[model samples]
Target chain A: MTGTEADHARHNARMLRIQQARAKMQARRTLERGLLIVHTGNGKGKSSSAFGMAIRSIGWGMKVGIVQYVKGSWETGEKNFFHAYPDLLTFEVMGEGFTWDTQDRARDIAAARAAWERSKELILDPDYDFIILDELNIVLRDDTLPIGEIVDFLKDRPLSKHICITGRNAKPALTELADLITEFGEVKHPFKAGFKAQKGVEY
Target chain B: MTGTEADHARHNARMLRIQQARAKMQARRTLERGLLIVHTGNGKGKSSSAFGMAIRSIGWGMKVGIVQYVKGSWETGEKNFFHAYPDLLTFEVMGEGFTWDTQDRARDIAAARAAWERSKELILDPDYDFIILDELNIVLRDDTLPIGEIVDFLKDRPLSKHICITGRNAKPALTELADLITEFGEVKHPFKAGFKAQKGVEY
Candidate 1:
């Protein structure tokens, strides 16, 4: 082969190598995956969103665990609905209604602590696909649980395990550490419009 | 009046009223507010399960809107992220990504048109609190828009609308109706391994 032809071939090989490298980089960019999420803010559907996710996960034939803090009474539709799918998911509500309704700080703390213990299993368990800590922010905000301890537990969880912490007023520390953070801000509310909370709608 | 006697009389009156209401015999179920939802099951964040409803709606301070049509796709890290907000209430994802991916066409069709055009206003107008069309089954499978008339107009709208749809088979009907419908299914997913999608973690 001529020297010029050989040089051309070398250049072509180098171009191919660069193209291959670019393709690999693109593939890597698209291959990203994992889980760490926080749903925070003064919106209404935080628990509902988490529940929907839990249900979807259950449908996928994945084991799901839920720890609902500060919402134990008043017969939630979700609790009833999920209960029907016993084989697919496991859920626990660790609350005694609203804090004002319960009016027992020590009892509330104990309930939250117990729920947290169960939540730890779901957060750390490799067998479980999702762990929902419902209304945990309320627990933290009310000083029912130690925020630092909760953060530490979450930070130390298995890399593959997914955790969902739902509630209003998510601490800045949690937000900063979260892989994904969402803040729900209120725009219009039925309560503000004189509409009473309706069953099968709000609760 | 004696305290005991007064209490007894009040209780008796309440009981009589209850009996009379029972005899009249009509269960009064609270009606769900009529809402128009647009769920296009064809996008990456589709089953992040409509963060628009779970987070943005809350930011808007509106009532909850939820419509889930599929199963799975719950583990994408958005579920936990959005559910943290309080104002953004209610989210429902059909959970299924695509019929071809799940190999269940019947389920997909059933889920797609479950409540067609019910979410039209939310898709078309900017007044809704939160409108989520979780995984719209029809659009993705047929590639036909879910609603011919509504979608075309939405494309050119300027309303501050909060809408989200998820699924792998976004049809023309959906594209027409959607202010935003994301399509997310596996181009080459990493879960084919012994790695089954985890519950709560993935969903």
Candidate 2:
């Protein structure tokens, strides 16, 4: 319970003012174009968040191209879902394995290069409205491809195409150039308790 | 180009080791109870991630119940998709608007209480395998209802039902109680550049 009728009336008046201001701000935002989005940090849901975006893009009746650079070998639930929608989505598992699994540095680099080449082909396709470079930052972090070179290549990407990159330690250059970047920070996780990641939850 | 045939063989051996460890870890994690998930912080995608979970849960042939606590006024893209699945999903918009729009603190509290009551009903229903308390953290952040009370009530929730609470600034008590907690940190945002959050992206 707040206060009297006068307090309620005052609050209502303030809300009106705020709504009007928001309307003005909303109207001023007229430009609509593709966005470079990055999801990075030391928490869970980085890849899942990108997969969420991929799902929403399909919800909008748009085609999505996904290049899984660091998580290539595993069978994921999201991948299975995408497989059901062959017409709207193309999911390519390009990485040899996780960094720990693919311990050889040179092999990892080669896989990253191949994945980037596939990304380039996907980005060039006018049919795709959304292209997800899943865990691409791990490749960049390994120096398989220079972050600057990727940024330079994406400079002239289609105006209406949105590209999302997800991983830990996204390059500063990419973050600066991105229209939106979200970092998933760890608050608490089951892994700390030695609870291994299960199929549906982890994948 | 990476390395020779010998290098490839060595890499494959490492991959096998990693896979065996992962498999052992996976086998040890046998707890399959429904998750109490919290998605919070200043960055975007908290709600969308939960919506993504709802989608995935549906993919598993489970019904989902959604209560939009603070974001009831706006027409969201996800809501539109859920509308098409009347038989499977029950999306109830139980708030007047965002707290800013509904500036009366008393009214906001009342709305939150009403929504919580609805949530209780959904949580009790065995038919719903997944219940998303979308933006419930924002309602709790305002101290309308005690966060501890909510967590206490959820402690003995259904064994097979998963509940996801999403919003910014989730209370420490709730986070501690949650099985999984993901905090979205802002690295970059379009709003800072005066670009409006568009449909499909923001909604």
Instruction: Please report, as a residue range, the 10-residue window in candidate 2 chain B with the lowest summed lDDT.
Output: B1-10
**Which candidate leads the pack in TM-score?**
2
Best by lDDT: 2
lDDT of 2 by residue, A17-124 (tens): 888888788787766788888989888777777767776677677788999987745766666567777998998998877766766767787888898899999999
Can you tell me which runs of candidate 2 are displaced by over 4 Å? A1-10, A102-107, B1-30, B86-88, B103-110, B146-148
Docking class of 2: acceptable
Candidate 1: interface RMSD equals 14.6
Model 2: how far residue B64 lies from native, Å: 2.7
Model 2 agreement with the true structure over B4-117: per-residue lDDT tens digits: 657666766776788789777767676666778899999988877777677666666678899988874576667766786787689999966875677776788788899999
> Which DockQ values do the candidates obtain, in the order shown?
0.07, 0.43
